[model samples]
Target: MSDPLFEEDEVPTWIFTFADLMSLLLVFFILMYSLSKMTETTLESALSSIQIALSSNGANINQSPRFYSGGGSKLIAPETPQLADTQDLTFSEEPIDTEEREQVNEIANDIANKMVSSNLSNAVSVFEDGEKITIRVDGQTLFESGEAQLSYEAEFIFNKLIDIFNRYPEYSISIQGHTDNIPINTVRYPSNWELSAIRATTALRYFLEAGFRPERMTATGYADSIPLVRNDSPENRAINRRAEFVLQKDPDLQKLYGK
Candidate 1:
């Protein structure tokens, strides 16, 4: 007969092995189910976090992340959404008065014809916008570099402009001076502002001496503030350095000039 202790200790080794195998199977199934339930958003978030971490570590990783599902299917991360290009979009401008625009165009045409006849076409340009007309003169054509004094060519241009002003007593003139981004410092012109202001005033004085009503004119200086184009090149900078004679219809001035 067997001892009582040995008999009590006796057990099936196979049963323990079977229980261990079942436990492993249960854990494997749970892991598979969890992996299958993972959403695209959750995976994408995890990928982004990983990318940020890699980037912080100075790792150059350009490839997008890919995940595997329980069914052995590959899931690639979604690409970032691109922003809309504002440059391609169209914007509406202020509506222009038809009759006023026509008048301004007529004045522009007259100026253009005069410029061609005077051989000053290349030095000047005329633009008509809404109720106003602009006669833009290249700065180099009127004055030397960094100088406010008018050149001989400026006198000729001013004479032609005065003739036009005599005819258009209904319009008010605004002389605006512009400059390039280059800095200037001198006893006469402390900065571009002074230079520009003096240049505008000089032109105004010429107009005043030509018997134009001073009340109908103004002088302004905008030093490298308003530019026609990007001041990145020599040509563009030259274009930006200009003086503009802006004419607008002024009813009060019309009466003042006996229009």
Candidate 2:
């Protein structure tokens, strides 16, 4: 019983639901396309902002309706304080690579063998940390008590060491002088600092005179600030008073070689 006034091609109730679904799908595709068009940096920034916003407790979503009255959504992201460009955030030393560590250990073992062969094992010792190789020589072997002059045996040892340095000219070397806790006030050395510095300089000068590159070498003094023992006994004090040679690894080379 169709009414004569009714149109034959009337719209179905399902049409309205279908139209709503299509509209939602279209909006979703538009959003996807917009996100795809964003640059990588912008995308990363947006993601970082979202992460920060989610993690922070300061986010305020209870703002007045006037905040989003302009038909645009609000993304509340609290600005984090950033370090200044001039501030150096990387102040720590780089880790040593396996190849560099092996190289350092090889050098240390070779030097130890040389000292043993020359019957100077008691005077000198070799150790390797992951980053560097340290060759420590007893102060008495190189200098008399309260004196900075190198002995005849010390000169021979330095010559041999210079030969080793020549084979590896690329290595950067540091010579450090350390002293026992005993205080000294001499006419030449007013304090332990002066004595320690002079001793380090004396060792550095020998290398420089042997034609080692000035730029590749450094000299420093610890002045009882870095001691091997507590200086509570004569044996411990003797161990504390020594000269050290440390060979540093090049950071760039380690990276290039894949540590």
Candidate 3:
């Protein structure tokens, strides 16, 4: 027999459990939302506190995701790529030779040491990628204001560089000139492109005069298109205006050297 005070629809025992579950879920979601709103430092502190509390109670924590460090940028396409062929293709591997790598490293080290020894560190910087190495020279150090001609001091610097290149015949050289975003409308150089090109050509001529093989050398200009940094600040503008001596990759040369 049913209790006299209780109706058929009177609050069921299961309804209390359901309400408690819903309340717990709501609180959990609220805590998660609050965690998201925390600053990096605050989030770290909270995680540390939680970890300490768990450890004191004999709970084992395996690993935590590293939130501070970030990987390098990867190129991402906006949409799925359309391939003309759906067949699997044969792939080949030809890693750079160990000897070639050593040679490049030696050259870079020698150049860096020479620059430092001569107190030209302020005007020059050396950078290396896997396939190539580049020696970048500050534009202001090489030429006068709005002039393409290499200065006397610049000539001295090039002479030192030439001594280094004379040893490495296998590597092809490229003189790349870069200019700031400033507009130039002179009769000689109507645009930044012309100015940049002439500067590169001027440097090329220097190497040629010093007995470098013309076939192994080339010149190119990048007119404010590929700046190292934004041209918003004067310091950044100065950095953007520069020249680079790049050791180019040549498959034929590599093959000749038994790569």
Candidate 4:
């Protein structure tokens, strides 16, 4: 038997622990909501930065141009583009005058020296002027008189040319065929026009087969026209009937002209 005043009992403290846990959960949700609002503000600031880059003030846009040093629009006092858009951005550029001409002349001289070393100076002439690099192939060397067919010696010349052209893959070449006033009507080919066109086409085909890019090569026929000589005498007529290989300028350069 126990005394009534000495009887004891235990009460659980777990109920208070449960209430503290619920309070912590409520605090967590409130913190999360505040962070979400801050995230939206940060996103808006980032978008504003991009928008500023796209839409600039009209006054600064005109007075300054976008010169990209590190692919960034570094504006100067004056800048313009011949064609400028989001997809295709082109900048207006100045023409390369005397300096560019000198450089091309130097390159042509070097090429001529190389051909000289290879012992190909007679049939082929390589030179550069103000506008283009010219390669003049004499008809006397490439073909027989009044004929479009390539001579046996022309094959050797063509092989040497292939070696030279393969090295500089960046250049674009155009082969032009010219003839004298002497007309031709053969079974295989009819008329001087057809003969010249065929010869140019044949030369172009050789270039393509020898691993040249088709886009970089062009063949043109000029029959009894565009004569270097007066075509009056036999010697002049012989000189007039010739083939020329011309190196054209880069097409992208048009963007500089703004036309």
Please report the candidate that would top lDDT against the real structure.
Answer: 1
Report the Cα lDDT for residue 45, model 3: 64
RMSD for all candidates, in order, please: 23.9, 26.0, 22.4, 27.7
Residues 17-135, candidate 1, lDDT per residue (tens digit)? 99999999999999899889998866666665554334311232222233322222333222222322433212214566787678778888998899999999999988776677889
Evaluated at residue 191, the lDDT of candidate 1 is: 76
Per TM-score, the best of the predicted structures is 1
The local distance difference test score of model 3 is 0.73
| Error at 219, model 1, angstroms | 0.3
By the TM-score metric, which is better: model 1 or model 3?
1
Estimate the overall C-alpha local distance difference test score of candidate 4: 0.65
TM-score of each: 0.63, 0.60, 0.60, 0.57
Clashes of each: 0, 0, 0, 0
- The lDDT for every candidate, in the order shown, is 0.76, 0.72, 0.73, 0.65
Candidate 4 residues lying further than 4 Å off, grouped into runs, are 1-95, 251-259
Better of 1 and 4 by lDDT: 1
Clashing pairs in 1: none
Please, what are the lDDT tens digits per residue for candidate 4 over residues 1-259? 8897887866579978999999999999998987677765455554544433432211112111122212222221212212214222111244558876786677678778877887878767886655567788877788765566678887888887787676555567899898765545556556668778888888898888888878788998887756665555556667767788877465643343332
**Residue 161 in candidate 4, Cα distance off native in Å:** 1.5
Tens-place lDDT digits, model 2, residues 106-129: 887888898899888988888877
